[model samples]
Target: MTITSPSSEAPDWPQCAHEADGRRCRGRPVEPYAACLAHIGVDRRAGHLAALEPGAGLDLRGTPFTRDLLTELLAALTDPATGRHRLGPADFEEAEFSGDAQFARVDFTGDVSFDGAAFGGGAYFTGARFEADLGFVGATVARNVWLDGVECGGGVCFNKTRIDGELRLETGTITKSAVFRGLVVGGDATFSGIEFIEPAVFMETEINGTAWFDGALFRSDVRFDGARIAGKAWFDGAEFHHDARFDSATLSEDVSFNGTRFVEGAAFPGATIGGDVEFGGNEIGGDVTFRKATFQRTTVLGPLVFPRLLDLSDAEFQSAVTIEAAVGTLHCRRTRWSSTAALRLRHAEVDVSDAVLQFPVSIAGRSHPFVADGRELEVPELSDAPVRVASLRGADAAHLVLTDVDLTGCQFVETVHLDQLRLDGRCPLASPPPGLRRIGRRPVRWTRRRTLAEEHHWRAERQGADGWTRAPGNTDVWGPAALAPVYRQLRKALEDGKDEPGAADFYYGEMEMRRLDPDTPPGERALLALYWAASGYGLRATRALGWLLLAVVATVLAMMLWGLPQDDPEPVSTGTVTGSRVTMTTDKPDPVNPQGSYGSRLSSERFEKSLRVVINSVVFRSSGQELTTAGTYVEMASRVAEPALLGLAVLAVRSRVKR
Candidate 1:
């Protein structure tokens, strides 16, 4: 067939346009192109490559071909090797594979475009170099695709492409933007160690197998928005120099971001994770958000350093959620907690001044509470559901809002953010987790103790106290003005729950704080002091018992010392004297009978007589023969006090314990 340039003015035969070494190429031109075969044109290279096959396989490097050569190229590449050298890879460089054609690899040196191409075989482009743009729009690869160690001077794209097998693009360098929107991968895909100088987009993509981006570096923004991963996804050791996003994505299996670094920001808003998600040991420099996202399984974030902020507003945790280390502002307003355990925060500090730290978590499951601070104390009416415990331990938080929280089966360790906290439902009582040791590492403690000194220290610090100053009788750090409201709120919560004993505990705290309050009225302070000393505000039954025991012992000792009280000496007539040396005389006949009444309520010790006097003094009963005197009245008051203490103890104990 006659070959000619695609021009109406050309004759049936057209000469080549390229010349080398001062001689022109005598080859005919290919249609629709200016250059002829053997002169930097497609037809010459295509026809030549179609005819020549090495002893083993096709070994045509630097051979230019056109879209018509796509099928023949695949056939030649798939053919079995015959000779040893022929088994080598088919090479193409400075060749035009044309638009709408795709291959795996070559030491490419010129522009290449596979726009709107289809491939029935693998797409392995390992160690390829491109001086110009490498496009793959509207392409399809039926088998595995590999693009390792590629270096591109221009931009790259895989837009609207579909692949039936794995696709790897690791260890590549693209000077310009790389786009992969609407792409689909059937098998495992990797983009590790890649450097995208400009932005990289993977929006609206779908991956059916595992996706690995380990050690990948993005110099510009990278986005995976609206993508879906049906299998596991890993981003280990990846570094995003610019903002990285996975917003609105769906992950069906476990995803990990171990040792990853985000220089700008990372976002996953409105995303859904069906399996576990962990970002252990990651350093996120900018704000990281998971707003309105849903986690179906365990979500673990630890050793993560977010320098700016962390926003989790309205996020839902169906399972357990843990934050081990976060050093930035934590915005967790209006979060929904559906997990059967409390939210756990360990070794995290959220001290940002302008952040929204309200923990208005809406509890969902019956097994879990809204939040917990690893300290445990048992209370009544606890749930019997298997312990699904969650806790936030070793964290310093401020301006917190903990409304409608239930800490029935939860514990907190080193968490000190209860001050100025907003509340709503069952005020999160610091009671022991329910059903001890049944679930979630919740501990059960039966003994009560004084408030911890460190806890108070932190409280004082938050209250703007410069130094530690214990209350008059208690070790509370916050003065009455700062802590009285908290105590009252807690008391009201317990009272609303009809837990009088619990309310009394808080009431005791309130009175204790008020008693030491410098601003309190002097009369009120005195009254509060008296109340505390007397009944410990109706909470310290044990203290009242101690006082009763002390009173009983002390009264007994006093009775022994006083011996017996004798009726005022019987009146006897005597003479008066004029001076200091004067003397008087009296008759001795009235005391002649020893068995007669002595007019003194004295009893002997043999029949426990002294014991009788002691018992009378303790019971506040008169021993008879008492000629009224101020001394006798004091004894009577002492006798009444011991029994009152005993009664107080009994009442206090009965109110709390179900006998």
Candidate 2:
């Protein structure tokens, strides 16, 4: 066949153009050199070209294809009697058109292919399955490209097909490996339900819109690390082998790896998936990192098990996240994790913050259990991450409620600060493993008890004046007394008060005394000894007047000096006589003065002076009137008990004048 370049002067070709156009030829004779407009010009239809019979391997080696020639060749191939199906570089190349080109089912026996075809318009291969190893290896389509429900055998290669519009490879099957490496799509590229029996490559593709690989199965690695996507990239239900990577790529919209099965491994390290990463049910094999990648939205990775590490270091989540379950450790070191909702580190190994550590009910499966071993979670290398305590001013932590939770062998690294942590579990001791090294190597067992015991004691001390006092008076008097001597002595050393031991000390002393004499009646012995010790007198005085003996002596001293004296003859000094030898006078009998005031002023002054001398001398001589006076005074009080009781009754009645 004589292959020629289509000319502008030539009539329109009927093979390549749409048959819907009137330019379509009704009949076409097989001619090597045809002048019919149906087989000549750029406007010709591809469906009108006559089928050429195969002849000793026909070749159109140097023939360049115009839009008209391509249309004609395509039309000729549609005819059965034409006996020709194979076409090559002799046909379409650099084809230009204003509309889409549809090539429904048409058989080509030989290697009929478009090695470097460039379609200015959209191209469609819907249901027009290729039987042989079809090749459109370096095709470029200006508009959208569709190959829906098409089948290709012996490996199809569109290694560098650049599509200006959306590229759809829906429900297609590539029996062998399909190569689309370095392909560029200006719009979205979808490969939904497309089966690749061997492997597929979409590596290094630039997608202007979403690049969907939903429901596509890859028997090998499906890499997208170097692929640039302006919109969201979805791989929901896509399987990976060997490994897959989106590392170092920029995603402008949300990126999903949801339900993707990573049988071997996967990596998205340093890839910014500007929106949320919904890995709701993904199975990850190897280590994954969003390390230093910024997520502008929530990154939800619910109920996942990564066999190795999953580092989210320095990643920031703009919204809330639900990480209900995680099998491996999630390192969120130095990350700015803020969420309006409660940040759940439930059951997941969370390594962040310092201040205090609190486990959640979700971790315990009931209420939050206080595990003493949690303090070991603190890794000093991450000291910069301080726990954020929201405030404790008006908000009461007591109001926060919780449920029962288990605390079986949980480790809290450092202090886990929480806003409000409620514990309803039993007090459990810290039991470290045989091989694990304790943090700081602090006396783990002793320190655990000491810490908890100190806290408990401190709180109890605040609740009352006693430390861990079960009831108001549950402890022995001596128990408080032991503290009293020390505290009182300290307080007395500070204040200007008597150096005498406090009353609390007396009670404590009484307890010690009773302990020495256990056979004694406890109440009687304690009360009796306490009274005497408190009174600073002998036991006799203590039993007779209790503590009231001190009051009696004070009253007596006041009355003697301040009350009226007898107005009869005054007795002379017995030590001195009336003679010049200075003998002591025994008595002097004097009649009452007319004014009944003889020696009254002198006597009163002498009496006052004498009483002062006596009182001072007595108190100073008898341990400051704390011994003899105390006993005598208490005995005298017992003697006037009846009259005193009667007087007290009258006073009590009189004191109730208002009532």
Q: lDDT tens digits, residues 1-659, model 2?
A: 22222233323332232233444322221233343333344433232243343221223322334455545556554435653343332333323333566665544333434444556677777775555565665667778888888776656666677788999888877777777767788899898877777767666678899988888777765566666788887888887765676676777787777677777766666666666566555666677777766566654544344445567666656555544333345565655544422333323344442211121212222112112223212222322322222111122222222223222222221222212334333423222223323324332221111011122232244423222322223321223223323223322321222322222222333343343344667786677565344432221222334334444444345323332233435567666445667655576554332234434434555355434433443433221222233334433443454234334434333322312
Give the top-scoring candidate (lDDT).
1
lDDT of 1 by residue, 1-659 (tens): 11111222422345557666664433344444546533544565576556644322232222234555555545543434421111222222222333333444443444565544445566667766665677777666667778888888878888888788999888989988999999899998898888888999988889999988888888999999999998998988889999898889998888888778888878999998877766665666678888888888855644344445667676777775654433334555455555433334322223222222334332222223222134221212222322222233322233333433344322233344533233443434443222333213434322242232332443344443333322334333434565565566555655654666656666665676688678999999998887677777656698888887777655544443343333324646588778776667775332111122433233444125335554566564665423224335546766678677877888878767732
The parts of candidate 1 lying over 4 Å away from their true place are 1-111, 118-124, 140-145, 263-265, 280-288, 298-311, 320-332, 342-345, 350-505, 510-530, 533-535, 538-567, 570-615, 629-636, 639-642, 645-659
Cα deviation of 502, candidate 2, in Å: 34
- Per-prediction TM-score: 0.55, 0.48
lDDT of each: 0.57, 0.47
| RMSD, every candidate, angstroms | 13.9, 19.5
Question: What's the C-alpha lDDT at position 230 in model 2?
Answer: 83
Top candidate by TM-score = 1
Q: Candidate 1 at residue 165, lDDT?
A: 90
RMSD in Å for model 2: 19.5
Supply the TM-score for candidate 1: 0.55
Minimum summed lDDT over a 10-residue window in model 1 is located at 82-91
